[model samples]
Target: APFRMSFAASAKHVRVLENAGLVRRKVHGRSHVIRLNPAPLAAADKWLRYYERFWRERLDTLEALIRAEDKAATRKRSRK
Candidate 1:
């Protein structure tokens, strides 16, 4: 917010954010006031957490399988 950018680029970025439902812009005379809308961002966070848990469980299972296979290979070599 402290930094400066071109008006055209700033408007384009604002438009993209508006389209994504992350912000709401209201025009007061010649000035545009932008407000943050948290609902969409919260929903996206929830979606990401759900998939994070899913991948964690999947990777745990894969790790267990790999460990078991390594132990089996070690035993086979020790018996030779």
Candidate 2:
């Protein structure tokens, strides 16, 4: 149901997708069949890699903080 499309709207949507490098269209009879192009995905993947590195650094900092807190708690318990 989600993939259901009318020819006119599909043509417009396909044009936008092609412009964005997200898809390619080939003429098949009266219809232009859409083929997915991977260029946009590659770009997205590159963008996400930067964010992944950022999150990894943040997580490492959090892990160190957690370990320090755990060691402090252990020391306090031992004294009590």
Number of the top lDDT candidate? 1
TM-score of each: 0.91, 0.64
**Could you give candidate 1's per-residue lDDT for residues 1-80 as a string of tens digits?**
56598888899999999999999999999999999999999999999999999999999999999999999999999999
Tell me how far candidate 2 lies from the true structure as C-alpha RMSD in angstroms: 3.2
lDDT of each prediction vs. the true structure?
0.97, 0.91
Show the colliding residue pairs in model 1: none
lDDT of 1 at 68: 100
lDDT (C-alpha) at residue 71 in model 1:
100
lDDT of each residue in 1-80, candidate 2, tens digit only = 56688868977987998999899888989876788999789999999999999999999999999999999999999999
Displacement of residue 58 (Cα, Å) in model 2 is 1.1
